[model samples]
Target: MSAFVAEPTTALEIESIGNGTGLWLPPEVRDEVERVQSGTSAAELTAGVVELRNLIGGSADLFHAAMLALMCGTMVEHGAEPGAAIDATLDLLVATLNTLAEDPDEMARAASRLSIPAAMTMLARSKETRKRWRARPEIMDRLEALEDADLAPFWLREVFTLHDDAPLLVLDPNNRRAFEFRLIGVRDRLYHCYALLQDALLRHTGPGYLGAEPVDPLAVRYARNDHLTPADYRAATTLGDHQRFAFAYPGIAFMPGSGTPAELPTVDGVPLLTVSPKTIHFNWRPANMYGVIHEALGSSIDLIRELSPADAEALLSRCALP
Candidate 1:
Protein backbone atom coordinates (compact mmCIF):
# COMPACT_ATOMS: atom_id res chain seq x y z
CA MET A 1 0.00 0.00 0.00
CA SER A 2 1.28 3.58 -0.67
CA ALA A 3 0.46 6.25 1.89
CA PHE A 4 -3.24 6.51 2.73
CA VAL A 5 -3.44 10.28 2.47
CA ALA A 6 -6.66 11.62 3.96
CA GLU A 7 -7.30 13.27 0.64
CA PRO A 8 -6.97 11.29 -2.58
CA THR A 9 -4.63 12.70 -5.24
CA THR A 10 -6.07 14.52 -8.22
CA ALA A 11 -6.13 12.26 -11.27
CA LEU A 12 -3.93 14.14 -13.72
CA GLU A 13 -4.65 13.52 -17.39
CA ILE A 14 -1.19 12.74 -18.77
CA GLU A 15 -1.63 13.16 -22.51
CA SER A 16 1.98 12.40 -23.47
CA ILE A 17 5.49 11.47 -22.38
CA GLY A 18 8.94 11.69 -24.03
CA ASN A 19 9.92 14.71 -26.12
CA GLY A 20 8.39 13.18 -29.26
CA THR A 21 11.53 11.05 -28.84
CA GLY A 22 12.60 8.45 -26.30
CA LEU A 23 15.35 8.23 -23.73
CA TRP A 24 18.75 7.47 -25.22
CA LEU A 25 20.33 4.04 -25.02
CA PRO A 26 24.06 3.71 -25.50
CA PRO A 27 24.63 3.08 -29.21
CA GLU A 28 25.66 -0.38 -28.02
CA VAL A 29 22.03 -1.33 -27.38
CA ARG A 30 21.80 -1.66 -31.15
CA ASP A 31 21.61 -5.42 -30.83
CA GLU A 32 18.22 -5.03 -29.20
CA VAL A 33 17.16 -2.81 -32.07
CA GLU A 34 18.23 -5.54 -34.46
CA ARG A 35 16.38 -8.10 -32.40
CA VAL A 36 13.20 -6.03 -32.62
CA GLN A 37 13.55 -5.55 -36.40
CA SER A 38 13.66 -9.30 -36.76
CA GLY A 39 10.41 -11.04 -35.86
CA THR A 40 10.17 -13.65 -33.14
CA SER A 41 8.45 -17.01 -33.47
CA ALA A 42 6.77 -18.70 -30.53
CA ALA A 43 9.72 -21.04 -30.08
CA GLU A 44 12.18 -18.15 -30.15
CA LEU A 45 10.06 -16.29 -27.62
CA THR A 46 10.03 -19.27 -25.26
CA ALA A 47 13.77 -19.72 -25.54
CA GLY A 48 14.34 -16.01 -25.16
CA VAL A 49 12.48 -16.03 -21.88
CA VAL A 50 14.79 -18.69 -20.48
CA GLU A 51 17.85 -16.93 -21.81
CA LEU A 52 16.98 -13.52 -20.36
CA ARG A 53 16.24 -14.88 -16.91
CA ASN A 54 19.64 -16.56 -16.70
CA LEU A 55 21.24 -13.24 -17.58
CA ILE A 56 19.31 -11.14 -15.05
CA GLY A 57 19.69 -13.74 -12.35
CA GLY A 58 23.36 -12.80 -12.25
CA SER A 59 22.79 -9.46 -10.48
CA ALA A 60 20.04 -10.25 -7.99
CA ASP A 61 20.53 -7.61 -5.28
CA LEU A 62 20.56 -4.46 -7.42
CA PHE A 63 17.77 -5.95 -9.49
CA HIS A 64 15.71 -6.39 -6.33
CA ALA A 65 16.13 -2.75 -5.26
CA ALA A 66 15.46 -1.45 -8.76
CA MET A 67 12.34 -3.59 -8.80
CA LEU A 68 11.07 -1.86 -5.69
CA ALA A 69 10.09 1.31 -7.57
CA LEU A 70 8.41 -0.79 -10.24
CA MET A 71 6.44 -2.77 -7.67
CA CYS A 72 5.11 0.50 -6.25
CA GLY A 73 4.27 1.89 -9.70
CA THR A 74 1.55 -0.72 -9.99
CA MET A 75 0.32 -0.07 -6.50
CA VAL A 76 -0.64 3.39 -7.70
CA GLU A 77 -2.55 1.73 -10.49
CA HIS A 78 -4.16 -0.26 -7.71
CA GLY A 79 -5.58 3.02 -6.37
CA ALA A 80 -3.02 3.55 -3.68
CA GLU A 81 -1.41 6.84 -2.73
CA PRO A 82 2.27 6.95 -3.74
CA GLY A 83 3.36 6.60 -0.13
CA ALA A 84 1.15 3.63 0.66
CA ALA A 85 2.04 1.98 -2.64
CA ILE A 86 5.77 2.18 -1.87
CA ASP A 87 5.27 0.92 1.66
CA ALA A 88 3.40 -2.10 0.33
CA THR A 89 6.31 -2.84 -2.02
CA LEU A 90 8.68 -3.05 0.95
CA ASP A 91 6.26 -5.26 2.87
CA LEU A 92 5.84 -7.65 -0.05
CA LEU A 93 9.63 -8.02 -0.13
CA VAL A 94 9.84 -8.87 3.58
CA ALA A 95 9.94 -12.55 2.67
CA THR A 96 13.36 -13.50 1.31
CA LEU A 97 13.93 -13.44 -2.44
CA ASN A 98 14.14 -17.22 -2.31
CA THR A 99 10.58 -17.36 -0.97
CA LEU A 100 9.40 -15.00 -3.68
CA ALA A 101 11.20 -16.70 -6.59
CA GLU A 102 10.06 -20.15 -5.53
CA ASP A 103 6.40 -19.62 -4.65
CA PRO A 104 5.01 -16.09 -4.50
CA ASP A 105 1.52 -17.38 -3.93
CA GLU A 106 2.52 -19.44 -0.93
CA MET A 107 4.53 -16.52 0.36
CA ALA A 108 1.59 -14.19 -0.15
CA ARG A 109 -0.81 -16.62 1.48
CA ALA A 110 1.47 -16.96 4.44
CA ALA A 111 1.85 -13.19 4.69
CA SER A 112 -1.92 -12.86 4.55
CA ARG A 113 -2.14 -15.23 7.49
CA LEU A 114 -0.10 -12.74 9.49
CA SER A 115 -2.46 -10.35 11.25
CA ILE A 116 -2.78 -7.14 9.28
CA PRO A 117 -1.66 -4.46 11.71
CA ALA A 118 -4.42 -4.19 14.33
CA ALA A 119 -5.84 -0.99 12.87
CA MET A 120 -6.17 -2.47 9.37
CA THR A 121 -7.91 -5.64 10.51
CA MET A 122 -10.23 -3.72 12.78
CA LEU A 123 -11.21 -1.38 9.96
CA ALA A 124 -11.62 -4.23 7.45
CA ARG A 125 -13.84 -6.26 9.76
CA SER A 126 -15.88 -3.25 10.69
CA LYS A 127 -16.55 -2.39 7.01
CA GLU A 128 -14.89 0.96 7.41
CA THR A 129 -12.38 0.68 4.53
CA ARG A 130 -10.93 -1.70 1.91
CA LYS A 131 -8.20 -1.43 -0.76
CA ARG A 132 -8.93 -1.72 -4.49
CA TRP A 133 -6.84 -2.49 -7.55
CA ARG A 134 -8.01 0.36 -9.72
CA ALA A 135 -5.82 2.95 -11.55
CA ARG A 136 -4.58 6.40 -10.50
CA PRO A 137 -1.85 8.94 -11.56
CA GLU A 138 0.30 10.69 -8.97
CA ILE A 139 2.53 7.65 -9.01
CA MET A 140 4.05 8.96 -12.23
CA ASP A 141 5.25 12.07 -10.48
CA ARG A 142 6.51 9.82 -7.73
CA LEU A 143 8.37 7.89 -10.40
CA GLU A 144 10.06 11.00 -11.80
CA ALA A 145 11.01 11.77 -8.21
CA LEU A 146 12.89 8.50 -7.72
CA GLU A 147 16.34 9.98 -8.41
CA ASP A 148 18.24 7.44 -6.36
CA ALA A 149 16.29 4.46 -7.73
CA ASP A 150 18.07 1.93 -9.92
CA LEU A 151 17.61 1.77 -13.68
CA ALA A 152 15.43 -0.94 -15.21
CA PRO A 153 13.27 -1.52 -18.31
CA PHE A 154 10.64 0.87 -16.97
CA TRP A 155 10.12 4.28 -18.58
CA LEU A 156 8.11 6.96 -16.82
CA ARG A 157 6.70 8.43 -20.04
CA GLU A 158 5.52 5.02 -21.22
CA VAL A 159 3.96 4.11 -17.88
CA PHE A 160 2.26 7.51 -17.67
CA THR A 161 0.66 7.00 -21.03
CA LEU A 162 -3.13 6.85 -20.77
CA HIS A 163 -4.21 6.99 -24.40
CA ASP A 164 -3.31 6.57 -28.06
CA ASP A 165 -1.92 10.09 -28.25
CA ALA A 166 0.91 9.21 -25.91
CA PRO A 167 4.26 8.11 -27.35
CA LEU A 168 4.01 4.41 -28.20
CA LEU A 169 7.65 3.49 -28.55
CA VAL A 170 10.91 4.36 -26.86
CA LEU A 171 12.72 4.41 -30.18
CA ASP A 172 16.37 4.07 -31.03
CA PRO A 173 17.32 6.68 -33.60
CA ASN A 174 20.38 5.70 -35.57
CA ASN A 175 21.46 6.04 -39.20
CA ARG A 176 18.72 8.67 -39.53
CA ARG A 177 16.16 5.84 -39.32
CA ALA A 178 13.94 5.29 -36.30
CA PHE A 179 13.82 1.81 -34.81
CA GLU A 180 10.32 1.68 -33.41
CA PHE A 181 8.86 -0.73 -30.88
CA ARG A 182 6.01 -2.50 -32.64
CA LEU A 183 3.20 -4.75 -31.36
CA ILE A 184 -0.28 -5.75 -32.47
CA GLY A 185 -2.49 -4.06 -29.89
CA VAL A 186 -5.05 -6.73 -29.18
CA ARG A 187 -7.28 -6.57 -26.12
CA ASP A 188 -5.90 -9.78 -24.61
CA ARG A 189 -2.19 -9.68 -25.49
CA LEU A 190 -0.34 -11.00 -22.44
CA TYR A 191 2.67 -10.06 -20.32
CA HIS A 192 5.50 -10.70 -22.81
CA CYS A 193 5.48 -7.00 -23.66
CA TYR A 194 6.99 -6.51 -20.25
CA ALA A 195 9.50 -9.25 -20.90
CA LEU A 196 10.59 -7.48 -24.07
CA LEU A 197 10.78 -4.19 -22.24
CA GLN A 198 12.88 -6.00 -19.67
CA ASP A 199 14.94 -7.28 -22.55
CA ALA A 200 15.32 -3.79 -23.96
CA LEU A 201 16.30 -2.52 -20.54
CA LEU A 202 18.64 -5.29 -19.49
CA ARG A 203 19.93 -6.25 -22.86
CA HIS A 204 22.42 -3.48 -23.54
CA THR A 205 22.52 -2.61 -19.86
CA GLY A 206 22.82 -6.28 -18.95
CA PRO A 207 21.52 -7.54 -15.60
CA GLY A 208 24.03 -4.98 -14.40
CA TYR A 209 21.79 -2.33 -15.93
CA LEU A 210 18.78 -4.42 -14.96
CA GLY A 211 18.97 -6.33 -18.25
CA ALA A 212 17.89 -5.52 -21.85
CA GLU A 213 15.72 -6.86 -24.72
CA PRO A 214 14.99 -8.09 -28.24
CA VAL A 215 12.92 -5.64 -30.30
CA ASP A 216 9.32 -5.59 -31.54
CA PRO A 217 6.18 -5.13 -29.46
CA LEU A 218 6.08 -8.71 -28.17
CA ALA A 219 3.22 -10.32 -26.27
CA VAL A 220 2.35 -13.72 -24.75
CA ARG A 221 -0.79 -15.68 -23.95
CA TYR A 222 -1.77 -16.99 -20.52
CA ALA A 223 -3.65 -20.08 -19.39
CA ARG A 224 -7.23 -19.16 -18.51
CA ASN A 225 -7.44 -17.82 -14.98
CA ASP A 226 -3.93 -19.08 -14.25
CA HIS A 227 -3.48 -16.11 -11.92
CA LEU A 228 -6.53 -17.05 -9.92
CA THR A 229 -6.16 -19.74 -7.31
CA PRO A 230 -8.80 -21.10 -4.94
CA ALA A 231 -7.26 -18.84 -2.33
CA ASP A 232 -7.55 -15.88 -4.69
CA TYR A 233 -11.20 -16.57 -5.32
CA ARG A 234 -11.92 -16.90 -1.63
CA ALA A 235 -10.06 -13.72 -0.80
CA ALA A 236 -11.62 -11.79 -3.68
CA THR A 237 -15.10 -12.66 -2.54
CA THR A 238 -14.27 -11.93 1.07
CA LEU A 239 -12.67 -8.53 0.44
CA GLY A 240 -13.80 -7.24 -2.94
CA ASP A 241 -17.18 -6.02 -4.02
CA HIS A 242 -19.26 -9.22 -4.05
CA GLN A 243 -21.36 -7.86 -6.89
CA ARG A 244 -18.42 -7.37 -9.22
CA PHE A 245 -16.06 -10.31 -9.05
CA ALA A 246 -13.92 -9.05 -11.92
CA PHE A 247 -13.46 -5.77 -10.13
CA ALA A 248 -10.52 -6.53 -7.88
CA TYR A 249 -9.98 -4.69 -4.64
CA PRO A 250 -6.54 -3.24 -5.36
CA GLY A 251 -3.76 -2.12 -3.00
CA ILE A 252 -4.13 -2.73 0.77
CA ALA A 253 -7.53 -3.69 2.21
CA PHE A 254 -7.49 -1.11 4.98
CA MET A 255 -8.03 1.96 2.84
CA PRO A 256 -11.32 3.05 1.28
CA GLY A 257 -11.81 -0.36 -0.40
CA SER A 258 -13.19 -0.01 -3.97
CA GLY A 259 -16.39 1.65 -2.92
CA THR A 260 -16.38 5.46 -2.91
CA PRO A 261 -14.11 8.20 -1.59
CA ALA A 262 -16.51 8.97 1.26
CA GLU A 263 -16.09 5.43 2.60
CA LEU A 264 -13.66 5.15 5.54
CA PRO A 265 -12.22 1.96 6.99
CA THR A 266 -8.76 3.35 6.20
CA VAL A 267 -5.75 2.05 8.10
CA ASP A 268 -1.99 2.50 7.77
CA GLY A 269 0.90 0.09 8.47
CA VAL A 270 4.06 0.91 10.47
CA PRO A 271 4.96 3.71 8.05
CA LEU A 272 2.03 3.51 5.67
CA LEU A 273 -0.82 1.18 4.67
CA THR A 274 0.19 -2.47 4.28
CA VAL A 275 -0.50 -5.30 1.83
CA SER A 276 -3.42 -7.55 2.67
CA PRO A 277 -4.85 -10.86 1.41
CA LYS A 278 -7.02 -8.66 -0.77
CA THR A 279 -3.83 -7.31 -2.31
CA ILE A 280 -2.37 -10.77 -2.93
CA HIS A 281 -5.47 -11.63 -4.95
CA PHE A 282 -5.08 -8.45 -6.99
CA ASN A 283 -1.40 -9.02 -7.84
CA TRP A 284 -1.96 -12.70 -8.59
CA ARG A 285 -4.64 -11.67 -11.03
CA PRO A 286 -3.23 -11.34 -14.60
CA ALA A 287 -4.15 -7.71 -15.07
CA ASN A 288 -0.73 -6.18 -15.71
CA MET A 289 -0.60 -3.95 -18.84
CA TYR A 290 2.15 -3.71 -21.43
CA GLY A 291 3.80 -0.27 -21.51
CA VAL A 292 3.63 0.04 -25.28
CA ILE A 293 0.72 -0.67 -27.61
CA HIS A 294 -0.36 0.20 -31.18
CA GLU A 295 -3.48 1.84 -29.86
CA ALA A 296 -3.63 2.84 -26.21
CA LEU A 297 -7.33 3.57 -26.45
CA GLY A 298 -9.61 0.49 -26.76
CA SER A 299 -6.68 -1.70 -25.69
CA SER A 300 -6.60 -3.74 -22.44
CA ILE A 301 -5.63 -0.92 -20.09
CA ASP A 302 -7.07 2.12 -21.89
CA LEU A 303 -9.04 3.53 -19.00
CA ILE A 304 -7.71 1.59 -16.02
CA ARG A 305 -4.20 0.73 -14.91
CA GLU A 306 -2.89 -2.85 -15.20
CA LEU A 307 0.29 -3.33 -13.14
CA SER A 308 2.31 -6.26 -14.42
CA PRO A 309 5.63 -7.50 -12.97
CA ALA A 310 6.75 -9.48 -15.99
CA ASP A 311 10.40 -10.05 -16.85
CA ALA A 312 12.09 -13.00 -18.55
CA GLU A 313 12.05 -14.83 -15.24
CA ALA A 314 8.28 -14.45 -15.01
CA LEU A 315 7.85 -15.46 -18.64
CA LEU A 316 10.06 -18.54 -18.20
CA SER A 317 8.48 -19.67 -14.95
CA ARG A 318 5.00 -21.19 -14.72
CA CYS A 319 4.65 -20.49 -11.03
CA ALA A 320 2.00 -18.05 -9.74
CA LEU A 321 3.98 -14.81 -9.35
CA PRO A 322 2.67 -11.27 -8.85
Candidate 2:
Protein backbone atom coordinates (compact mmCIF):
# COMPACT_ATOMS: atom_id res chain seq x y z
CA MET A 1 0.00 0.00 0.00
CA SER A 2 1.22 3.50 -0.79
CA ALA A 3 1.99 5.79 2.22
CA PHE A 4 -0.57 8.55 2.76
CA VAL A 5 0.63 12.07 2.01
CA ALA A 6 -0.38 15.29 3.85
CA GLU A 7 -0.20 18.84 2.60
CA PRO A 8 2.06 21.24 4.52
CA THR A 9 0.50 24.26 6.29
CA THR A 10 1.95 27.57 5.09
CA ALA A 11 2.37 30.75 7.24
CA LEU A 12 -0.72 32.10 5.52
CA GLU A 13 -2.69 28.99 6.58
CA ILE A 14 -1.42 29.28 10.19
CA GLU A 15 -2.37 32.97 10.32
CA SER A 16 -5.93 32.27 9.18
CA ILE A 17 -7.14 30.40 12.31
CA GLY A 18 -7.57 33.37 14.71
CA ASN A 19 -7.28 36.11 12.13
CA GLY A 20 -10.95 35.74 11.08
CA THR A 21 -9.90 36.60 7.54
CA GLY A 22 -6.65 37.25 5.63
CA LEU A 23 -7.57 40.97 5.73
CA TRP A 24 -7.86 41.27 9.53
CA LEU A 25 -5.36 43.69 11.12
CA PRO A 26 -3.61 42.88 14.40
CA PRO A 27 -5.10 44.52 17.54
CA GLU A 28 -2.22 46.98 18.09
CA VAL A 29 -2.39 48.13 14.48
CA ARG A 30 -6.18 48.39 14.68
CA ASP A 31 -5.93 50.58 17.82
CA GLU A 32 -3.48 52.89 16.06
CA VAL A 33 -5.82 53.14 13.09
CA GLU A 34 -8.74 53.93 15.39
CA ARG A 35 -6.79 56.71 17.12
CA VAL A 36 -5.80 58.28 13.82
CA GLN A 37 -9.19 57.92 12.20
CA SER A 38 -11.00 59.58 15.14
CA GLY A 39 -9.26 62.85 14.34
CA THR A 40 -11.52 65.29 12.45
CA SER A 41 -8.66 66.85 10.49
CA ALA A 42 -8.34 63.87 8.12
CA ALA A 43 -9.81 64.07 4.62
CA GLU A 44 -13.56 63.33 4.64
CA LEU A 45 -13.16 60.41 2.23
CA THR A 46 -10.35 58.84 4.24
CA ALA A 47 -12.18 59.41 7.52
CA GLY A 48 -15.36 57.86 6.09
CA VAL A 49 -13.39 54.78 4.99
CA VAL A 50 -11.85 54.44 8.44
CA GLU A 51 -15.25 54.86 10.06
CA LEU A 52 -16.73 52.18 7.79
CA ARG A 53 -13.88 49.82 8.67
CA ASN A 54 -14.40 50.49 12.39
CA LEU A 55 -18.15 49.90 12.17
CA ILE A 56 -17.50 46.61 10.33
CA GLY A 57 -14.47 45.30 12.25
CA GLY A 58 -14.39 47.06 15.63
CA SER A 59 -18.04 47.71 16.40
CA ALA A 60 -19.33 48.28 19.91
CA ASP A 61 -23.00 49.06 20.46
CA LEU A 62 -22.34 51.22 23.53
CA PHE A 63 -19.84 53.30 21.57
CA HIS A 64 -22.31 53.80 18.72
CA ALA A 65 -25.00 54.87 21.19
CA ALA A 66 -22.58 57.31 22.81
CA MET A 67 -21.70 58.88 19.45
CA LEU A 68 -25.33 59.23 18.54
CA ALA A 69 -26.16 60.78 21.90
CA LEU A 70 -23.35 63.31 21.52
CA MET A 71 -24.28 64.30 17.99
CA CYS A 72 -28.05 63.87 17.99
CA GLY A 73 -28.64 64.37 21.74
CA THR A 74 -30.80 61.25 22.02
CA MET A 75 -30.23 57.52 21.63
CA VAL A 76 -33.85 56.78 20.68
CA GLU A 77 -33.51 59.48 18.02
CA HIS A 78 -31.20 57.05 16.20
CA GLY A 79 -32.79 53.66 17.02
CA ALA A 80 -34.04 51.62 19.97
CA GLU A 81 -33.00 48.56 21.97
CA PRO A 82 -34.24 46.53 24.94
CA GLY A 83 -32.85 44.92 28.13
CA ALA A 84 -29.85 45.91 30.29
CA ALA A 85 -27.85 47.19 27.33
CA ILE A 86 -30.64 49.58 26.44
CA ASP A 87 -30.92 50.83 30.00
CA ALA A 88 -27.17 51.36 30.26
CA THR A 89 -27.09 53.11 26.91
CA LEU A 90 -29.93 55.36 28.00
CA ASP A 91 -28.06 56.22 31.20
CA LEU A 92 -24.94 57.10 29.22
CA LEU A 93 -27.03 59.19 26.83
CA VAL A 94 -28.57 61.03 29.75
CA ALA A 95 -25.14 61.77 31.17
CA THR A 96 -23.74 63.05 27.87
CA LEU A 97 -26.88 65.06 27.06
CA ASN A 98 -26.80 66.59 30.51
CA THR A 99 -23.21 67.63 29.94
CA LEU A 100 -24.05 69.23 26.61
CA ALA A 101 -27.10 71.00 28.00
CA GLU A 102 -24.99 72.44 30.79
CA ASP A 103 -22.42 73.87 28.41
CA PRO A 104 -23.46 77.27 27.05
CA ASP A 105 -21.33 77.17 23.90
CA GLU A 106 -22.42 73.67 22.96
CA MET A 107 -26.07 74.38 23.74
CA ALA A 108 -25.96 77.51 21.60
CA ARG A 109 -24.46 75.63 18.72
CA ALA A 110 -27.09 72.89 19.08
CA ALA A 111 -30.11 75.16 19.60
CA SER A 112 -29.24 77.96 17.19
CA ARG A 113 -32.20 77.07 14.96
CA LEU A 114 -34.44 75.25 17.50
CA SER A 115 -37.57 76.72 19.15
CA ILE A 116 -38.42 76.51 22.87
CA PRO A 117 -41.80 74.69 22.58
CA ALA A 118 -40.38 72.22 20.08
CA ALA A 119 -37.24 71.72 22.15
CA MET A 120 -39.32 71.18 25.31
CA THR A 121 -41.55 68.69 23.51
CA MET A 122 -38.44 66.77 22.41
CA LEU A 123 -37.08 66.83 25.95
CA ALA A 124 -40.38 65.60 27.40
CA ARG A 125 -40.85 62.73 24.97
CA SER A 126 -37.24 61.55 24.49
CA LYS A 127 -36.09 58.96 27.04
CA GLU A 128 -39.54 59.65 28.56
CA THR A 129 -37.50 61.50 31.22
CA ARG A 130 -39.02 64.73 32.55
CA LYS A 131 -35.99 66.59 33.93
CA ARG A 132 -35.73 70.23 32.85
CA TRP A 133 -32.63 71.53 31.02
CA ARG A 134 -31.62 74.91 32.44
CA ALA A 135 -29.07 77.26 30.96
CA ARG A 136 -27.78 80.74 31.79
CA PRO A 137 -30.46 83.46 31.58
CA GLU A 138 -28.99 84.98 28.40
CA ILE A 139 -29.04 81.65 26.54
CA MET A 140 -32.60 80.98 27.68
CA ASP A 141 -33.66 84.44 26.51
CA ARG A 142 -32.19 83.76 23.08
CA LEU A 143 -33.95 80.39 22.91
CA GLU A 144 -37.25 82.00 23.92
CA ALA A 145 -36.96 84.67 21.19
CA LEU A 146 -36.55 82.22 18.27
CA GLU A 147 -39.65 81.71 16.04
CA ASP A 148 -40.86 78.14 15.36
CA ALA A 149 -40.75 78.66 11.58
CA ASP A 150 -37.02 79.58 11.68
CA LEU A 151 -36.09 76.34 13.56
CA ALA A 152 -34.01 73.65 11.88
CA PRO A 153 -35.49 70.14 11.75
CA PHE A 154 -32.12 68.50 12.53
CA TRP A 155 -31.55 70.72 15.55
CA LEU A 156 -35.08 70.15 16.83
CA ARG A 157 -34.74 66.39 16.25
CA GLU A 158 -31.46 66.27 18.20
CA VAL A 159 -32.76 68.37 21.10
CA PHE A 160 -36.12 66.65 21.66
CA THR A 161 -34.73 63.12 21.32
CA LEU A 162 -32.41 63.39 24.40
CA HIS A 163 -32.79 61.03 27.37
CA ASP A 164 -35.52 62.06 29.84
CA ASP A 165 -32.90 62.25 32.59
CA ALA A 166 -31.28 65.29 30.95
CA PRO A 167 -31.38 68.54 32.90
CA LEU A 168 -33.39 70.93 30.73
CA LEU A 169 -34.77 73.75 32.88
CA VAL A 170 -34.19 75.21 36.32
CA LEU A 171 -37.17 77.41 35.64
CA ASP A 172 -39.50 74.77 37.05
CA PRO A 173 -40.36 75.58 40.64
CA ASN A 174 -40.41 71.87 41.63
CA ASN A 175 -37.24 70.68 39.88
CA ARG A 176 -35.12 68.32 41.93
CA ARG A 177 -31.35 68.64 41.95
CA ALA A 178 -29.29 65.85 40.42
CA PHE A 179 -26.01 65.12 42.17
CA GLU A 180 -23.59 62.22 41.72
CA PHE A 181 -23.33 61.03 45.31
CA ARG A 182 -21.24 58.04 44.25
CA LEU A 183 -18.44 60.28 42.99
CA ILE A 184 -18.43 62.06 46.32
CA GLY A 185 -18.24 58.71 48.09
CA VAL A 186 -15.31 57.70 45.91
CA ARG A 187 -13.53 60.98 46.58
CA ASP A 188 -13.89 60.48 50.34
CA ARG A 189 -12.35 57.03 49.95
CA LEU A 190 -9.49 58.49 47.92
CA TYR A 191 -8.84 61.16 50.56
CA HIS A 192 -8.73 58.48 53.25
CA CYS A 193 -6.13 56.59 51.21
CA TYR A 194 -4.06 59.76 50.85
CA ALA A 195 -4.08 60.41 54.57
CA LEU A 196 -3.14 56.80 55.40
CA LEU A 197 -0.30 56.83 52.87
CA GLN A 198 0.98 60.09 54.30
CA ASP A 199 0.96 58.72 57.83
CA ALA A 200 2.64 55.45 56.89
CA LEU A 201 5.39 57.19 54.93
CA LEU A 202 6.07 59.55 57.85
CA ARG A 203 6.33 56.63 60.28
CA HIS A 204 8.48 54.42 58.03
CA THR A 205 10.87 57.16 56.99
CA GLY A 206 11.66 58.06 60.61
CA PRO A 207 15.12 56.99 61.78
CA GLY A 208 13.84 54.31 64.21
CA TYR A 209 11.89 52.25 61.60
CA LEU A 210 14.58 52.63 58.92
CA GLY A 211 17.16 51.03 61.24
CA ALA A 212 15.03 47.96 62.07
CA GLU A 213 12.77 47.31 59.00
CA PRO A 214 14.22 44.49 56.84
CA VAL A 215 15.15 45.53 53.28
CA ASP A 216 12.22 43.70 51.60
CA PRO A 217 9.77 44.77 54.29
CA LEU A 218 11.31 48.19 54.29
CA ALA A 219 10.77 48.41 50.53
CA VAL A 220 7.24 47.01 50.68
CA ARG A 221 6.24 48.50 54.02
CA TYR A 222 7.71 51.82 53.09
CA ALA A 223 7.43 51.54 49.33
CA ARG A 224 6.53 55.23 49.03
CA ASN A 225 8.86 56.59 51.71
CA ASP A 226 10.44 59.74 50.30
CA HIS A 227 12.70 60.91 53.14
CA LEU A 228 16.27 60.29 52.05
CA THR A 229 19.58 62.11 51.73
CA PRO A 230 19.26 65.29 49.63
CA ALA A 231 20.80 63.50 46.63
CA ASP A 232 18.56 60.47 47.13
CA TYR A 233 15.50 62.68 47.53
CA ARG A 234 16.21 64.26 44.15
CA ALA A 235 16.68 60.85 42.55
CA ALA A 236 13.43 59.55 44.06
CA THR A 237 11.55 62.68 43.05
CA THR A 238 12.69 62.11 39.47
CA LEU A 239 11.03 58.68 39.49
CA GLY A 240 7.60 60.35 39.69
CA ASP A 241 7.53 60.86 35.91
CA HIS A 242 8.67 57.30 35.19
CA GLN A 243 6.25 55.68 37.66
CA ARG A 244 3.39 56.95 35.49
CA PHE A 245 4.69 54.66 32.72
CA ALA A 246 4.81 51.53 34.92
CA PHE A 247 2.39 48.86 33.60
CA ALA A 248 2.45 46.41 36.53
CA TYR A 249 0.14 48.62 38.59
CA PRO A 250 -3.28 48.99 36.97
CA GLY A 251 -5.66 49.68 39.88
CA ILE A 252 -4.45 53.25 40.32
CA ALA A 253 -5.17 55.81 37.60
CA PHE A 254 -2.65 58.64 37.91
CA MET A 255 -3.42 62.27 37.23
CA PRO A 256 -0.31 64.23 36.15
CA GLY A 257 -0.10 66.77 38.98
CA SER A 258 -2.22 64.90 41.53
CA GLY A 259 -0.07 62.40 43.45
CA THR A 260 2.77 64.77 44.23
CA PRO A 261 3.21 65.79 47.88
CA ALA A 262 1.55 69.19 48.16
CA GLU A 263 4.03 70.98 50.42
CA LEU A 264 6.86 71.34 47.92
CA PRO A 265 7.80 74.94 47.13
CA THR A 266 7.63 74.16 43.42
CA VAL A 267 4.16 72.61 43.73
CA ASP A 268 2.79 75.46 45.91
CA GLY A 269 1.85 72.98 48.69
CA VAL A 270 -0.53 70.97 46.52
CA PRO A 271 -0.39 67.19 47.10
CA LEU A 272 1.11 65.25 44.21
CA LEU A 273 -1.89 62.94 44.00
CA THR A 274 -3.46 64.29 40.81
CA VAL A 275 -5.79 61.95 38.90
CA SER A 276 -5.42 61.95 35.11
CA PRO A 277 -7.24 60.08 32.38
CA LYS A 278 -4.54 57.40 32.08
CA THR A 279 -2.32 57.59 35.19
CA ILE A 280 -2.24 58.55 38.87
CA HIS A 281 0.76 60.65 39.79
CA PHE A 282 2.61 59.40 42.89
CA ASN A 283 4.45 62.70 43.06
CA TRP A 284 4.94 62.43 46.78
CA ARG A 285 8.64 62.64 47.78
CA PRO A 286 10.31 59.17 48.01
CA ALA A 287 9.91 59.40 51.78
CA ASN A 288 6.16 59.48 51.16
CA MET A 289 5.82 56.44 48.87
CA TYR A 290 4.92 54.28 51.90
CA GLY A 291 2.28 56.78 52.85
CA VAL A 292 0.80 56.55 49.36
CA ILE A 293 0.67 52.75 49.65
CA HIS A 294 -1.14 53.10 52.96
CA GLU A 295 -3.55 55.52 51.27
CA ALA A 296 -4.10 53.00 48.47
CA LEU A 297 -4.82 50.31 51.06
CA GLY A 298 -7.33 52.57 52.77
CA SER A 299 -8.99 53.30 49.44
CA SER A 300 -9.08 49.56 48.77
CA ILE A 301 -10.72 49.02 52.13
CA ASP A 302 -13.42 51.53 51.27
CA LEU A 303 -14.00 49.80 47.94
CA ILE A 304 -14.09 46.35 49.56
CA ARG A 305 -16.83 47.53 51.89
CA GLU A 306 -19.18 47.62 48.91
CA LEU A 307 -18.56 43.97 48.01
CA SER A 308 -19.46 40.64 49.64
CA PRO A 309 -16.94 39.39 52.20
CA ALA A 310 -15.70 36.65 49.88
CA ASP A 311 -15.23 39.06 46.98
CA ALA A 312 -13.60 41.62 49.27
CA GLU A 313 -11.15 39.05 50.57
CA ALA A 314 -10.31 38.00 47.02
CA LEU A 315 -9.71 41.61 46.00
CA LEU A 316 -7.51 42.27 49.04
CA SER A 317 -5.47 39.16 48.34
CA ARG A 318 -4.95 40.25 44.75
CA CYS A 319 -3.88 43.74 45.85
CA ALA A 320 -0.92 42.46 47.89
CA LEU A 321 2.02 44.53 46.64
CA PRO A 322 5.31 42.74 46.20
Superposed on all Cα atoms, the candidates' RMSDs to the truth, in angstroms, are: 25.9, 25.0
Predicted candidate 2 versus true structure: per-residue lDDT over 244-319, tens digit per residue: 2211122443323233222211112211222112233343433332223211111111111123445434433444
What TM-score should be assigned to candidate 1? 0.19
| TM-score of every candidate | 0.19, 0.17
Which stretches in model 1 have alpha-carbon errors above 4 Å?
1-20, 59-322
Top candidate on TM-score is 1
C-alpha lDDT of all candidate models, in order? 0.26, 0.28
Separately for all candidates shown, the number of backbone clashes (residues 3 or more apart, or on different chains) is 29, 49
lDDT of 1 by residue, 5-107 (tens): 1122112201111122322233554355335223245344334323322332232332222222332232233333333323343333233223333444432
Pairing residues by index, what is the TM-score of model 2? 0.17
What local lDDT does model 1 show for residue 18? 17
Candidate 2 Cα RMSD after full superposition onto the native fold (Å):
25.0
- Quote the lDDT for 69 in model 2: 27
